[model samples]
Target: MDHKQSQIQEAEHAKRSYGSLLNVISKQYGSRDTQYADFSGECYKAVLEECYKKAKIDPSEVCYVEADGCASMITDAMELNSISEVMCKNRKTPLPIGCIKSNIGHTEAASSLVSIAKAVIALRSGIIPPNMHYDSPNPNVPALLNGVLQVVTEPTPLTGNIVGVSSIGMSGTYCHAIIKQNPKVKPTKEPASPIDFPWLVPLSGRVELALNTVFEKIEAMPFDEEFIALAHSIFKTEIKQHLFRGYTLLNAGQQRVHEVKPYDGAEKRPIWFLFSGMGSQWTRMGVDLLRLPTFAKAIRLCHDVLLPKGVNLLEILYSDDPNVYASSILHSFVGIAAIQIGLVDVLKELGVEPDGLVGHSVGELGCAYADGCFTAEQMILSAYARGRASVEATLIKGMMAAYVLKDVINFLGLGYNQIKDQLPPEIEVACHNSEFSCTLSGPVEDMKKYIDTLKQKGIFAKLVNVANIAYHSKFIKPAAPALLKYLKQVIPEPKPRSKRWVSSSIPEALWDSELAKYSSAEYHTNNLLSSVLFEEASAHIPAKAIVIEIAPHGLLQSIVKKSLSKCTNIPLINRFEKDTLKHLFQAIGKMYLGGIDVNIGNLYPKVDYPVSRNVPALHNLLTWDNVKGELISSFMKNKKEGSVIHSWDFIKIYDKRIQNFLGYKINNMEVIPPTVHLVS
Candidate 1:
């Protein structure tokens, strides 16, 4: 995360990097500092020797030198280049030395700092800066005469990892530090996060008001090129999360950030996992999630497996090319299954296992994995087979016109048993989501006719735009044989289910039976041909459970909340959100508040920002600056201008006793001070 570039954006960098430590170093010293100079030659040698020993490198590897260039650093006197040659005997060419003081002037106290800073820049850029105003080297210098030292009068390439820095103090305190090149890679033009997505900065405060106020402040500031770097700073969560927390959503497209209401939702409750099925799959569902490495890896794993089977899950889940998810039944099934696996992997990475679990319809594929019944590959391949088998019914042309999952407003559901006799026999309940909520699937024309009939009677119903295949119905019976055959071949045999795994498709009465066992092909075939008993499944959720919907988008949130009214329901993804990645983080924050031990570090990218040690303040130096005088001047100016005279009045009061005494003592005497005016 270091932004110290040697050049390129010179104008911008100049403002921030132009300043250096002036007070920490000693000021310029003249002939009186002969004592400090006496040890200069010895000091340089010791620093060089100590650096080589510490780094375990030879003198030949020290190719660049940042010299202090003070009065006596290279004096010709008794100090010998022949002595230096003996120390650096392995050198092929003279040591290239550059003077920073030639350009920035001798910062006596800060000379060593200036030298090191220049050396660091040189090491990073791999090129030494040219010494300014160097007409010729002094002929008296022993190193210059013996060719032991080469003054870098022109720009030169720095070829080694280590560079030596020398600084001489006026107080006889010689200090030296080494500058080693950092081999770390830096961010290029393309950042890890895509430009189209918004940057959500999760914020926390000790008090609720602070979160909102800080969000408002963030929104008021101007945005520019460095905003992504700002995202890195905001992503740092080491600061203790306080009682109140929230996030500010920033999109590069917008000039200002969108503020969200702050909350103290970390109320601590048991976390339950609920996986949503088919209708939740949307085109490009994985576009934002792919940015999450843990999630993307799972998706890629599934993609690599499913791609060879003529089903491209990556395109299905992340492409909005002419609604591939809706038109192709295979894409729909594979996309939902692939996204579910990714979501499960991300949840595990977050370190929150389901205290309780339920999966609706196709979501059962993900549920089986979460319950340890199916591995990542088995889940993905099972979904591929389910969709591949669904091709058997493609020509039949049927669709599911459900009462829910298309949107939140049509939250009402049908109790399948209650309405069993009312509908045409061709139309059957596909899913019983809640006490009054369910999905109805039938032939495409019949489904539309039924919905239109309801519409004429002023009842609202809409087509599930994401799904055109009539799943979980008699219409899907044609694909059952193929589905079962493929599933049996793919899964081979069912694994033992976890006790915490609740059944959404299988009723609670059959939970103890082989039906809840998800016994390979038969269970999946039966699941497709029968309605989802989600209401029966949610019965097993704990009274205080905090439910999280695991899918590319949310569909069963309303049903979960209604069934487990006492529990908290947090849908991890929203199809309508600007950035699903941000939505996932907010969901994790909710789970964290609900007592789930989520790994907070997993939510953000790894970052390492360089830090500097604290030093004495620059106020130690004497200056012509007068702050108090300016403050008083400002105060007087404001006081003079920022005032108004509202009203003025004069009051004359006579003291009866004094007036009487004066009038009696001296006749014709008027005891009055001349025009006395009092200003208060």
Candidate 2:
């Protein structure tokens, strides 16, 4: 009990204190037994179990599980209650397991990410990549040994759309993600239908050079049906900012890249709606747009309003017979009004509100309707009255022709005077369309004589296909009084709103009370014979304004472009395009690039279907600069990777084998480009 006994007791006390600290540390961090089990098994099990629970899907639905098999990472993942075993055990068809680590070696913390990426790629490509290096199953991993889960040693066809990816951390922190293939979410691709329209491909990059480079690469690539769809997918899901942009057109197996232009970061710009007039009307215009519910609804409402007036508008819109009542003044004006109004509805639904409106000839009626100067019924009634009166008043048959003069301003003054003196008395310059384009109207024979005389002098002049010669010329004078009388009966007084309406007849901007004068029958009648001041009206538009041609086919795009020069002009619809959906979405994409707000919910309506999640290759451009060169090189090195099935490939398969099922002939077969067909 002396000094030696005291020293021994002190040492024992120190040992006890140290041992207590060790026990506290172990308890705080988790038991060594549990940690080891987690790193090898239960951590992954909990992650996968929680993932499955949150996703509310059974393991049987999963086609495969991307496993964590890096070195000792496999030791814990192979435990009895691990994700693959628990998730796949009850299934009649057990889930297959794959390890990307086996192919490229364990990537450490990044290993899990690599595995997740591989799983995503596998799901998208519909090919289960082979799990390399495991000639024999690990004796310690019971799932592989007992056949509870199968490791995919060979490249296998993906059985279904859903896949589960698992990753384990060295510190017992594990994670699992569920990746599903939606039939509707797949990257945009060429549809089963044939290519019939020029598809606009929106292309952009963070910088001008980047955009140009991307465009050059795209241009050099072989053209295929997927080309347009690929461009669309990128524009829809990537390129959040449009600093520099250019778009290409895919037509007849050729891709043409437009000049790249820079976008000045959003200074709020006004949007101008350019309503095209009579010549814009075509047989079956808006026929394809009927597929859009909102557009069709608008057309139906308009048709209902015009039907009682005795114009079977739908007959011209939906009929396969292109000539059915298409050229009549009554049918043309009513049809034109109905379609333009429908376009306004569609544009509004997509959040595009115009700041100003302009119209050429009968297009002014649409502008009046859009500006709230008249109701839909009133607008149709006015158009009907105008059409009926014009037909009733025409004493002599006349025609209009487009004359591209060498000098527009001169033609408006001195040149027009000289031309007027030389031409027959009946001829008159009706419309000054652009700096160099104008419309010549007179008696059909006089107009023909003038056109022949102009051609003799080597002038760029051609006969315009127009049924109604009652626009902006004396030829329409006989109908003016009748139109005024009819308008007085229909719309007695115009209630003008504050919305801006640019009168192309005067080539001037007018709004609110100023538009009231046009409501009178006499004013409307006088307007029918006035010169179209299109250039002057265009000059008045704001420098930052984006001019949109709100018509079925963008017949006015070139006209607007010529008028605006450097300003951006977007065509709301493509006249030559058969797929109205593509054209509508492409226009929206172009709108987005121009800093326009888009209502995504309204753009894509609610639908119940499985969408494919396979996005196009251009989506890779989203992270183009961030991706490693080695990774790209390695990806390109795999010859079998080239053989992987893709959405485009599937489309080709459908074209060659599935399209003619049961030997039935499909009506209106879409023209398949030679490039896509030749690939097979």
Give per-candidate clash totals: 8, 20
Instruction: Name the lDDT value of residue 633 in candidate 2.
Output: 21
Worst 10 residues of 2 by lDDT: 18-27
- Residues 1-680, model 2: lDDT tens digits: 01112121332222111000000001122355654534445444555666666667776787887876656634544643476566766787656888897788755646755776677667667788998787877766666677877888888888887776666554555566666653444234444424344444566665667777776666655544333443443354333345565665545234252556655443556888888776777777888777677778888887887777777777768876665544577777777788888887778776677898877777777787777777777777777887798778855777877765555445432234345456677877777677656677778777777777777776866565556463677667788778888888877876644437766665333433353346556546656878766656666788768888877668767556655776678887786775665676667667766756555335333322112344344544443565555432211112333121112222453565556533333355554433333234
Give the poorly placed runs of model 1, Cα more than 4 Å off. Answer: 1-203, 213-242, 249-267, 317-320, 393-397, 404-413, 444-449, 465-469, 542-544, 558-567, 585-597, 608-680
Error of 2 at 327 (Å): 9.1
Mind sharing the TM-score for model 1? 0.56
- The candidate that achieves the highest TM-score relative to the unseen native structure: 2
Candidate 1 lDDT tens digits, 1-680: 12333332333232122222111222232346365534445554555566556656676767776665664534432133422553357887788877787897755545655677687667656688989877766666667667777778887887776776666555445444555565443444333443444555555544456556666655554432234243334333323334444555555344454334333333345667888877787768878888777888998998899878877777676575867876776787778888888888888876677777788888878778898888899888888888778776554567776564223575444566666777887888887767666677888888778888767655565466534567777777788888888988877878877877777667667778876676467777787777888878887787877888988788877667677788878998998988778777677666654545555445455433231211111112113346556421110112233221233333344655335334322246653332121111
TM-score for each predicted model, relative to the true structure: 0.56, 0.59
Residue 202 of model 1, lDDT score: 53
